[model samples]
Target: MNNIILSIIFFLMLSTIVFLIKSKKNISKLFLSILIFVGVLIGAGLLYLILMIFDNDTNISDTIKTMIPLIASMVAAASVVIATYNTVNGEKSSKNKTILEFIDITRDILEKGEITEKTTEILEQINSKLKSTDFKVDVLVNNGAREFFEFLNAVEGKEKIYILDRLEKCFYYEPGSPLDDLKKELIRKLKSNNIKDMRKLWVNINQLAGTPAKNYNILYEECSYSLTNQFIEKDLVNSKFYTDSLLKNDRKIVDGLLRKHFELKYEDIPIQYYEVYRVCNNILESNYEQIGHFFRTVHRTLKTINSYYERNSLEYREHIGMLRAQIPNQVALLMFYNAVYSEKGRGMARELLASNFFGDRDDFHFENNELLRSEHFLNNGRFLNNQDAHIAYELFTYNKESNKVYNELEKMEKKVVPVDDSETKLKEEIFTHYLFNKEKILLDKFIKEFHTVPRKFDEYKIFMNPKNNKK
Candidate 1:
């Protein structure tokens, strides 16, 4: 009889405590539950003992023994049921916390055009936790699918571009994610003639080399929408986008085609037509020393681009001429950045420059080492003070005058430039030539000679902004 009473008390106490801990219920409630169990157990025990003591029948002990077993079984079953219920509720609560946290992060991305490193760390933690369990991983993916569609319909302009880029990148770690579908859906929208700035779209699409998202057929179909034109020929090298896409294909055919083209050049196709193409060859095939030499001498390449710009009017309507005008500073800008910043593989960033158009590519590729360094370099964040290196070539290319380039560089070196007095004449004389070349050797030298240096991720929003692809 005593053992029966002790067993009932033990079950009640154990089950209540287990439920309280598992459910993470309030401590006060746990205490109250314990008190209730103990009071009931004591009362039941005392009553049973009293009944046994008063019994006078010869079969009383046997009857009491049977009653004790039946009561204990009922009590054990009830305690187990309570514990199971609490444990289930606890699991649901944990899942709810993950869902809410994911939603909050999605909202942050939508509102700020950025996310902090702390938030990224939190998301990583959540991702780790979710992967560690079978619960709620599908829930996040389902929610992501919903969010992806909603973003497709409602978002637009630069912000939409940014958000979509982040969406694909943020959930890249997720299995069976809808990002692949989301990209394909957006590409369909682009091809279906439902969106604006299709020209810009082609440029952005070409920048997607070295990515898992490379779907060349979708790109060709989209290109036919806006790019099948007088400026375009049925030939393989029709537009910069076509050339960039071709370079994206890695095969002996491209290499053989490159060899043949180099062997025989028809001058009708301007050097501008073949220069970037040739650079692409060097980019994909060059040895380390050869690449170093090319960067070291790239100022000469910039000069050739400047020469092309001088012969054509910036107002030229032919897409070829317009592309010609855009390529010079585009080359300088990308090459300078690829050389200076040590983020993405130099090869990756270099290849991206092949598809470069009017500098908006920076906004889309916010994470590239090149873009990251440019961000801080322009803002004078840590490495450089003269942002003129960022835009000096733009003015130089536009005006076809070395003086315009000289002026920006001169402005940057104010301690040396514009001093007409006799004391600084020699200093001005030396700095004069450095500031005013058709192709400034100084910038090229900076790129070629610059060794990969360490940078802090926290210094710019680029690193903390998540590994997003807004660039």
Candidate 2:
């Protein structure tokens, strides 16, 4: 029986040691664990003493044995109360409350560019938290960013973006710039920026990151993204986050976010076109294919946006969670997409027919001009009021018998076309306008939108067929 009890005590000690080794990292928590562990050991020792006292024939002292039990109980009870109080109080002031503590520390640092020793200590704590793999790792960073953003919104108004911009600029300046130089540089900016309210201009590099800013693109990007994301949360449109450009260095953050979104594999990609466009604007010149794949996220109506920009399996998943889209909205979006992608100075991609505006004289890609349907029409469904603009858009999108369009054009003087909410309406409207107006510019624009059609059709050969100009 003694041997069995000894084995049980041995196993308990082994388990306690393992738990201690695994969990006793924080100094404050370490004391609590040790205190509890010691209590266990003491209780075990006292019980063993009592058992031995009864088992052995030691002379006298039943009174001593009785007093021993009462004393040990009192000591054990007091030890628990003391340990509990210390651990709880330490926790309230330190590690577990790091989020709240970090936020206050960050705000103060941003307001004054002073980097104090407490800042360094907080850095140590922030780094330790970051080393943790659990979600709590981001608690300090996340809360700090949100609080700073709220502070900006409450006071700075639209100028908050300008202040946020300065904060990004100050924090992400030349990497590895010594703390002293960074301080001087910030002082110069503060004096020269001439903004009366500089409260929103502070950036706490220590609280945001536990290190210097030279190799800080990723950290800087995280801060900017966090704030912009908050900016978006506060107001989706008038404070439109995507309408503005981000620092060029932050492109990797965009790519990283895109990869995460791809991992989600949502059917309709929950992001707005403007948001994706901001990403594409950042990456299109550098990573055309990836940005192209990302651009495939327009609504189903402008299916060509997906197919034309980048045709991949991801583009065709045909889902977008609970969001729905209309043809007009998606078209306007791609118009912006096409113009941005086709702008000059994009390295070798500048020569691709896909990268030139439709109006460019040297522009030669007719098949890819499906995006022109959007260029001609406004997203709000109002601006394409000119009849010729509508005709030009129809010519590019609906690949129908050219002879039928020619016949409709020729006969429009006699009767109004019986067309409705269908492709037939567009054909009649376009043909009637072209037949009567017949302006050379309109004729040329119409043929250009359909440059792939056979060049020799008898009735439709009303002007120079654009297919002959194909490269």
Candidate 3:
């Protein structure tokens, strides 16, 4: 009877403490919970002692037997409370540590003047201290590369281009220069499928070669083509180097890749041209309003498409050829619209669009093709009759006014020599000489070099205040 009463008291005490702890809200509920369990066990032991005193026939063995369960419950509660506290504190500490580490790294990089040396030291420190975490390993490597290149550029000027050229001629280039040994080493690593090690070597070579230039494309092709092909094991249509080249806007690399990939066979499908075209079309379709870059790429693609059509070898002859003719101009207009609202690029945007529209291609202008006309050619709209004022406004800003200013100014600058056999011969000879000179010799370059792009009266008038008429 005494034992039963004690169990009831124990249960009530536990319930009351839990409710109190929960309601108070500021107490350490974990510790309170542990204390409640201990209090309940003590109550049970008091009840066992009371029963022994009341009965007098119950011995010490009976008292111990009753106390055993209470002792166990107290120990279990204490263990759980200690474990919960440790876990909560440990997690909080770990989260704080991670945040501090990232902040430290960002601050160190942002503060350093000699970023390359700093980054190199950072890598060594991470290896020695951070124990090489995968979460930021690649990011660290890429950051280090950027820092190193920026440092090199600051010190070397444009002569870094020549240094890279010479380096290429030394290490995996130049016959009998131990390149054979490196080849053997690479083959062994590749056979082992040591992708991590192979990537490291490629990274080292790229750093040693320095910043990407026209010549880097040639060296990358020579070094990685066969190996990358074997690594991919699927008739590699595009090299990793080519993808990197794309990100850098190195058109020279792009052109070389197109030529190389065009000849490779893939599972009864010639995939290179098609793949390149598809990626381009995806870029065009998705990001039409932001295609400042699509102009040059589209121009190259169209030239290739024309070549294919002329040979009658193009698989998607009609569609690709039509797209090639049309998409570049559309991209140009969209880019112009995106730029015009901005203060910085407005004039350049207008000038670029006008030049592209009026530049050569007499053939495309006269052709009565609806696709070409709708996509590229400019047309006047009847605003008053159709009440199409918005369309008229768009046409005015995009074409008529801009083109008029561009053409008038362009013609004003030129000394329009009358068409003569002697003058044409002189021009032809000048162009030939310019072509052989290996320097920029275009009309744009000539204008910039000489500071001679003539300004038209209309463009000049926009900025000037009109003279007041006498009343």
Rank candidates by TM-score, best first. 3, 1, 2
Q: What are the lDDT scores of the predictions, listed in order?
A: 0.37, 0.35, 0.37
lDDT of 1 by residue, 361-425 (tens): 23223233343433223443322223223332232223334334334443555544555577586
| Candidate 1 minimal-lDDT segment of 10 residues | 457-466
Candidate 3 per-residue lDDT, tens place, 281-388, comes to 443344434333333343334333333322223332342433424433423343332232222323333334323222323323322222123333342321011111
Residue runs of model 2 more than 4 Å from their true location after superposition = 1-150, 153-180, 187-275, 286-337, 340-471
TM-score of 1: 0.20
Q: Score every model by TM-score.
A: 0.20, 0.17, 0.22
Which 10-residue window in model 2 sums to the lowest lDDT? 454-463
Error of 2 at 36 (Å): 99
Angstrom error at residue 117, model 3: 19
Q: Is candidate 2 or candidate 3 better by TM-score?
A: 3
What lDDT score goes with residue 89 in model 3?
54
lDDT of 2 by residue, 1-471 (tens): 533444454456545544644563444555655756665576567566766666544522553455455445545654555566566557645532343333343334333533233233332332333233221212223333333345435554443455446446644445565543543444443344333212222222222221223253334322322222222222223321222222233333233322232232212222222222233354334444422322233212233222222321232222111111112233233333333223321211111112111222222223332223334332222211222233333432222433234334334534555566668868787766754463333334333433333222112111122345354
What are the RMSDs of all candidates, in order? 32.5, 35.2, 32.2
For residue 54, give model 3's deviation from the true position in Å. Answer: 1.7
